[model samples]
Target: MPVDQIPIGTFSRITHLSQKALRLYDERGLLVPAARDICTGYRYYTFAQVERGIRIRHLLWLGFGLSEVEAILEARERGDAGTIREHFARRLAETEREIGRLHAIAEVLRTQDPLNGGFRMSITEPVIKDIPATRALSRRERGVYQEAIPRMIGEICAYVYPADGRQPAAKVTGPIMFICHDEEYRETDADIEVALPIAGSVNLDGTAIGVVTLPAGRFASVLHTGPYPGVGKAYERLFAYMNEHRLVPAGPSRELYLNDPAEVPEDELLTEVQFPVEDLPLSP
Candidate 1:
């Protein structure tokens, strides 16, 4: 062994990086060892690599992905603070979003916890009816359906009921309407529009808030009672009804919240699932 060469064990201990991690970095060429025994294939590091090993540890501790850490190290080598700053900024934004998502999850667990007994779902027979036109203040966004629904609901309500003691711009007429504009189910990046039915006129005051008129349509609607997680079963039943009746969905599906989730327990929450449908053509 060379006098200056440090064995993998000593290197791992000195840098506080595991031998497994050191091997990964070597394979990734992020922190390759100084030398290796040709016959035994054992990795050896030098004192010069101690600084880089510590840097890698620090970067990993800071939550940088392996690839991002490599980029950061390369940027640092070229004195490219801008690149480092960009990575930092992007990571900062992602961390903020994750924090918000966690907060939302906590709120759900506190208010609408359905995990106690796995909220039992009860669905009623589907009914075909004509839906009337109504005015609503809506927020349409693209995101994960589950996470975005509650967050956007709060966002829209905040505007109507400002924190400061100010008069509400519009009167809430009915439960919120959640419309999914996608033909297929999506875990993320699905188009979601949440509309709050309002009777009184709303003064937008040049804001981005949208006032939409829900067009009249024929829809197959069903009543679902239980937690939102089990609401998919209700959807399945509704679609089965449509299939039996030879009806095809003509537009996006919607869910009208029949009860305030904040006030009701998850097992007792009510939601009306509706899907616009049209009759199939007769065979010639």
Candidate 2:
């Protein structure tokens, strides 16, 4: 209540925080008391400390860690405007990323309807075309019924598109897809390629793996958009489509990369979902 000091309980009240939380903050060096009585050893916070406590509470609400909050507060105390500005910029970037993820979630929810469900599967006859033997700067991973594969594909795309001077072409084409090297989990080694159709040999550091001639055939293809978990649902729809049409997939289902991770909105990622297959013969 006084200018020089206030009771811990009063400080907690002014800061709108629980005593337990206040104590934790103090222990974490987030908000230390201004003084303590020698005999009673009771914590006392200066009136100014109340304002700092309130600031800490607000920073915590913004998802800053105690250390981050302390650093920001220290910068303020030192009148270091540049450090404050940098912290805010970093916070803004983090906030934007969080918003992007939430927006992707919202988009998936909106597209869950049958009319525009997450996947569009269609069957077509085999056709032949000449595709340039292109080099892909890829990163491979084990996808076996795991969500990590999708992220690996994205990281690969991000690495290639921006770092390799291939981003411009990435804007024109489709959603990214995965190329499965084996059947299901039997061949546990899943090598996913983030392919960009380049004109010539691009100096890439990772293993080239091998060339896959995507044979043109009667295939059931689906377009999967959005992030990892959402793509799983799309794969489900593809399987359902095959079941409904009595189609038997002839070869390993492969994903065709159509968007650069660095440039495309992850929600709107374009992937050509291709499955080599043959229609089940009509029963006599």
Candidate 3:
């Protein structure tokens, strides 16, 4: 009833925050009422609290949780710009990851077949073969799944094959292979290695590239002939085959690029997906 205090209804209208939310915030000690009527138990807010309420609403709209808003407000009260900047940077990165996940979900929906109640792509049996060990030059980088593989491959090729009439120092032995080190699907910071088998040793002292030798082993592999996004279907079949046959994986999985994306359409791109397998256990 005091002239200085505004009732909860009027405060909610002014701040654009629902009355229920204000009560919850008060209960959580995020924003306490400026005054409370002892007899009637009515909540009231002072004019000064109007700015704080509006700031909380704006932060909520910006996708910040109540705890995050509290931290930011506390930082602001302490005049700590560095903490505020750090919080904003972290929120930005989280938003980016969420966006990436949403995009991946959209891709799955677009590829699904409603009529058959299954995915549109079909997975075939993989060929089993023994692979020989080889030495190669490799470049490892942490990046997102789709964009990193092609970009790293281009960088390696540019280093090995220069356009200026200079002879190449190293001889490329076989198709480029991508070794996936992540145990599961990751939208960001996925560990990937791009390797090119080289016939001779090449100096990589000053660059990010290094020399690596791939161990010879038996592998189960399938030819994935389509866009990269749909290659998961091939992996599904390959893993299912391994599980059904009681074959255990021995090393990191690899993808041999049989054709260049720049030279062919996405649907025509060929990739040989290979998983190194341990030998079947001797019969008990």
Candidate 4:
């Protein structure tokens, strides 16, 4: 019972940290009590520990892990402002990325239809057409779907536009398109290819970037105009049409960007969704 030692309950009240959390922190070697009665095994922390306890709670509130909190505490003990700055800068970047992801999720939720309990239907009708074979420059990558698509497209455009002396691909045969190779919806590690149709070939180098031919085929297509997040509804409509018409998908799905997103408002962006299909006989 040292005069400087504070009982666990009193320390908990002072720091606003629950007894369970204090015990867990002790178990994790994050915070150790100043003394423990050998007979009763009751924990006691010093008055000075109250400041550390409060700091730990604040760090936890800021989404820092136990290890990170320990590191920050160690940096403070050493009076290393640089280390603290580095840790906080890294955390700020991570928080910004999380915020972006949450905004994207919110956008998707906003576009859902309450009646259908699904994404709002955007396209009323889809056209069936035969697409001609074409050659193009492409870049393929695997990453989070919504976040990765735009970045990959921008990288491809950056490389292609300047490599060709700022000239638009001769005749620019078709709109910029993305071939979705994944068979099912994926939140991460989606297989995507960004392609630009060129009337003539240009030399390009890179393992992930190259020239490739897009196969010609009959496709069931719909035009979706609005933010990209609402494109899911267009896919729902396309699949429904395919099921009703008894058509089987023959190849990967494709999305043709009809306008530059950088130039138009997100709500006004245009995209043409196409799914290659094979026709089956209608049932009597």
Estimated TM-score per prediction? 0.75, 0.52, 0.68, 0.71
Candidate order by decreasing lDDT: 1, 3, 4, 2
Cα lDDT of model 1 by residue, 199-241, tens digit: 8778887655788988789999999998776688788889899
- Tell me each candidate's RMSD, in Å, in order: 4.6, 9.0, 4.6, 4.9
Q: Per-residue alpha-carbon lDDT of model 2 for 1-284, expressed as tens digits?
A: 35788887887789898889887887888787888778887788887677777888898898887778889998998999999888888788667766866876676676654654553323233332233333444445554323445566556455545766655423323344566766555433455444333344344456343223344556676666655445555566777878887878777666775666678766656666667777788999
Where in model 2 is the C-alpha error above 4 Å? Answer: 1-3, 38-40, 114-133, 137-195, 201-229, 234-270, 273-284
Best by lDDT: 1
Report the candidate with higher lDDT, 2 versus 3. 3
RMSD (CA, angstroms), candidate 1: 4.6
lDDT of 3: 0.85
List model 4 lDDT by residue over 33-103, tens digit each: 98999999999999889899999999988888889999999999999999989989978866877898788
Ordered by TM-score, highest first, the candidates read: 1, 4, 3, 2
The TM-score, computed over Cα atoms with residue i paired to residue i, of candidate 3 is: 0.68
lDDT scores in order: 0.87, 0.63, 0.85, 0.84
Model 2: colliding residue pairs: 126-217, 126-218, 174-258, 175-258, 175-270, 175-271, 178-255
Which residue pairs overlap in candidate 4's backbone? none
List where candidate 4 sits over 4 angstroms from the true fold: 3-6, 10-16, 28-35, 46-59, 64-94, 101-121, 163-171, 205-208, 279-284
- Of candidate 4, the 10-residue stretch with the lowest lDDT total is 115-124
Better of 1 and 4 by TM-score: 1
